[model samples]
Target: MADSVRSPRERYREQVRDEVKRHAWEQIASAGVTALSLNAIAKEMGMSGPALYRYFASRDELITALIRDAYRSLADTVRAAAEGGTTAVALAGVIRGWALQDPHRYLLIYGTPVPGYHAPEDITAISDELLAVLLVVCADPAAEDQKSPFDVLLGAKRGWVAKVLASPRTVHRALSFWTRVQGVLSLELAGHFAPMGIDPGLLLAEEVAEL
Candidate 1:
């Protein structure tokens, strides 16, 4: 309600910012993130470079906004699945579906690092939300029977995991699950599996079922 009651000036500013981000995504699609130019976007939007700077102080700031949006979106999707009593396998499927729906957004967050770009601490907070949901869904009682060496090491500092009330083994399991899913998505998005006649979806199902 408070948001809807925002003054006209605030609403217009947000609209402009949103428009700039749309153009920025188009630029990212055509060229890479390194090729993003605020000045170019200003020309495309009929605004001077300095004027656009009022909306986004620097390219890094705009990139942060994009990254934050991406992470927040994935976090929300997984959180919803978790709240709906999604199982480990089902949650993995949900994540896979989300990635398939928007490969660009998925890659933007988890793909190669943007050179000279450092994500703010808030981005880490959003990513931690993802891990938290993974931990919840990955709590397998059968996993408690097997203790790997890595699990033993991870058990020592269960600081964050403890906050989520997940065992060290569950944390290990969640990490394993996340890495496998990400590996498949990264390779699949890059079109590496097509040439090999490999089915990424089947591969993902097998990987998640193993957990």
Candidate 2:
């Protein structure tokens, strides 16, 4: 009977933790980061004030966990997108799809700067992993072909060395694509397009075409 009671208690704890995180996400979506509060979230969950501290040390710790989860989710999305394609554009579209699905979540990582706010090292490391995936996808195959663009930039330079260093160009392309896509997404989420009567889908398509 004691073991059975222990299993149910653990399950209840997990359920409560998940409920709190869900409410926290809802609060974040409705208001900005400044609006997130453990007390409010607990109230929304029908729990007393002190109950949340058992799950999260503080609001900062909860925010940190959410950021980590966000990065991991993005990394997974990009990895799935890269599975069958070697094109940077393909990966860019995957990221765009993700942004469209949850602009609020996207902004949590890329929105307006917060003073004294620093992302945890693990989040940055996951971001690097995503960048590495983009790098691999953007590697130019034409570098080895006879009709390559290296001729314009590597004139009179060591061809082999230039080929080896072309990875930076791929990285630049990936970063540029991400930035452009994010701009459209952020503006759309903030209702910058509704007033102008512009269609964000068309803009997103144009950006993808430019890639």
Candidate 3:
């Protein structure tokens, strides 16, 4: 038991921090972010509130951490999809897959904005990375005739902002795709479709086809 009493390596703190964040994520999944409470989380962990404060200076810090993680996860998902294939179609499928797996988490990033809520710089940076992946997937030199609103908006440069101004149609397609997909996802997550007797998968496929 003496060895158990000994502290783990300082590096372990990061692991502990992740564990806390994972629990926090679970909480967010079950309930909206507005429902998150540190005391409740501590109780869920079978610890006192003070224990979590050691890692998160305040509730805001914990929320910021979660937002950052959400962005990173999205960036990784898009990056993996881009690396896996060409076709904007496939990339759009990847985005839908990620959103379906955890709609609540996706909304945490793109859902209705809260009043007075400001995201940290890293969140926007990660979001840009995700968009960059989309730009790469959508860019088609051979299919210049198929340019969308985004292509015109994005113009010639395909980096960050260039992707924004290339083709207006492509930009509209991207935004519409995102909003439609999220609309379906948000509705499903909120159980709004149960009464309508419509299959979300069908709606998702149709939206993807439009993209």
Best by lDDT: 1
Q: What ranges in model 1 sit over 4 Å off?
A: 1-3, 158-164
lDDT of 2 by residue, 11-39 (tens): 77777777887888899888877788999
Task: Name the regions of candidate 3 deviating beyond 4 angstroms.
Answer: 1-8, 114-116, 140-169
lDDT ranking from best candidate downward: 1, 2, 3
Instruction: Please identify which of the two predictions, 1 or 2, would achieve the higher TM-score against the true structure.
Output: 1
The global Cα lDDT (0 to 1) of model 3 is 0.72
The residue-by-residue lDDT of candidate 3 on 104-136, one tens digit each, is 778888787644568888778788776666555
Please say which candidate is ahead in TM-score: 2 or 3.
2
The list of candidate 2 runs beyond 4 A from truth reads: 1-10, 143-166
Name the 10 consecutive residues with the lowest summed lDDT in model 2.
143-152
**Global local distance difference test of model 1:** 0.89
Report model 1's TM-score to 2 decimal places.
0.94
CA lDDT scores, all candidates in order? 0.89, 0.74, 0.72
How many pairs of residues collide in each model? 0, 0, 23
Worst 10 residues of 3 by lDDT: 161-170
Q: For candidate 1, lDDT tens digit of each residue in 1-211?
A: 3658999888889999999999999999889788999999999999999999999999999999999999999999999999989887788788989999978788889988999999999999999999988887788888697988988887777466567677889989899999999998889999999899988888998998887
Candidate 2: the clashing residue pairs are none
